[model samples]
Target: MPFIRSAGLRGLRATITSLDGDADHYARLGGLDPAALDADDILMPDLAAATTLELAAADLDCPDLGLRVAGHQDLSLLGPLALAIQNAPTVAEALECTSRYLFLHAPAMRLTLEPDPDGVDGVAALRYDVTAPGVAPPPQGTDLCLGSLHRAIRSLIGEDYEPLGVDLPHPPLAPPATYEAFFGAPVRFDRPSALLRFPSRLNDVALTGSDERVRQLALQHLADLSPAEAALVAPTVRSAVDQLLGTGAPEIGAVARMLSLHPRTLQRRLADEGTSFALILDEVRSSVARRYLETTDLPLSQVAGLIGLSEQSALTRASRRWWGQTPLAVRRVAQSQRTVA
Candidate 1:
């Protein structure tokens, strides 16, 4: 139900020269009527539809096209979030802020940071592919997102700051040149999550444009815009569950506690909406499991733990029920689709 600003759409139109003409045509092609979109924002689904439709209409196939579009966007495109990032003292803190508030920008998607397992001793990463609960991002949206993130970091650190490398879950949608020109580092595909890895030392390096005063003002402005508790409960619960996934199988009571609600209260609330804590937790795990398996390079055992299953065998059983095939089989099918798409 969350929405993205029209800045991205406006940026897209400006960047893609071939799509010139009335904006309504592109909006319509993307499964939306331009008239329906407010001057300020577009429904998230409309944004996704527009993206997919634009790809077909433009006859474009560059995997990094998303990167290009994202790279071209100015800080004005992000508004408050960008203001917060520019004011943060360090790259790490900036990234953390972005990860924490990404739901505001793209509530359906998440951006998580993890230490890179194989990089120069101290490196961290931000994974791509976080999507809305039941919907995947439009095909090129991830590219745009990751590209934008990388560029944002560059703007803070220095334009020449080279990243350690990049990782992507899906195979390339275009030639190697499609990535080489944008990333300026080795790009590995079908690996783990789509990630941008950089030296951990970079985390502490002060951003060039730090302005604590402006950042504080921006933070306050954002805080004022937060939705009420009643509206926040679901996202708060989902976020807490995502954080808890790798620790152990999450319990309803613990999740309730995290939300500062009594277990009974949480149960009654969800039930009133025709669901329950167990269903929500299972749904979250199942959704993330499908995504990690179909997209990321996370191993089954690790993924099992991440999604709250006790062991690999347990994950296998669940996957069988969910997809009617082994997890690996699902990955294989996803891989084949990428190759053929």
Candidate 2:
């Protein structure tokens, strides 16, 4: 059995809430027992595995009802929770309370802030590292988790909080339109880690107006969590390609530097892993091309440039080589499927 990592529990909670009604729709389509997902007792790992299986079986269109349920529940709970912390005095005290109390409703996720280089900017971010024992090749759950977190935080802060950027450990794909809709910013995937970058202005917002009593309670709650649970940090590789693609075309040395390794060492490591840097780059570009062709109304030429192809002809050849079909042909097939659905 694949163990769902603890780091992902908060995200799991958020996803479950967001997809509550969609579960029944999917259960019917996928021949699943809807009763298994009743509110009184939600199946976490079972639901995650079942959802992943159904998504693969259904061409990734299955509504992730479980995730929606988690999201909805999380949103409902975070408000009161945030208010509880906000009642406390001092930004530091409120944060301390929040960090300690947040886990009562969702699994503890790490929050940290560091001074930006100029000392004028403060970078605040949250992270959760899930570990599922014996789970080989975990799917990109962080994407969904962060998707829910973005919604939850925005709800707390109001709609005007513009984030600097978001980083994920997987390549970009279709689905979770929330990232683009909510953040109104570029989302970078396949980076060194998962992060949400925001200006330090957010730090000034007091967590709660409450006195020190609430602060003390929050801190004690945090201290009560098992030390064993605190050690959960899942391994993830931030995609160098995602970073490079955000800028212009990237050189090999530059990509290597971002990964904090020498170019030669990076090449040798990739080769040992039975892949080459060139092959992975092509794979990333191809994946992006497919997503653009399927989801967006962008012209083929623009899509080509977006993925670093200099000309439409080059993109055409690459798409043909990767998918054994022309870009237009692929788009037609995707459109046809959408129409059928």
lDDT of 2 by residue, 1-341 (tens): 23233233333333433434354454444444444334322334534544543453344343333233334433444434555555555444444555544544434233333333122446665443222211212233554556556665565566556777776544454454644554566666544345566776675765433556764554565456436534321110124564365355656778877667788887776766667777777766776677667655668888788778888999899988988999999889967865774
lDDT of 1 by residue, 1-341 (tens): 45665555444554455444444555666765564333435544636544644464346444455666676665556669889988998887887777766656655567777657474567777776546664544546666667777777777888647887887656676676778678888888766456888777777888876899998898877777666542545555666676677678888788998778998988887776667767778778887788787777678898898788888999899989877999899879977876676
Candidate lDDT (C-alpha), each: 0.69, 0.52
Candidate 2 residue 174 C-alpha distance from true site, Å: 18
Candidate 2 similarity to native, TM-score: 0.49
Best by lDDT: 1
Worst 10 residues of 2 by lDDT: 129-138
Candidate 1 least-lDDT 10 residues: 35-44
Error of 1 at 117 (Å): 4.6
Query: Each prediction's TM-score against the native?
Result: 0.77, 0.49
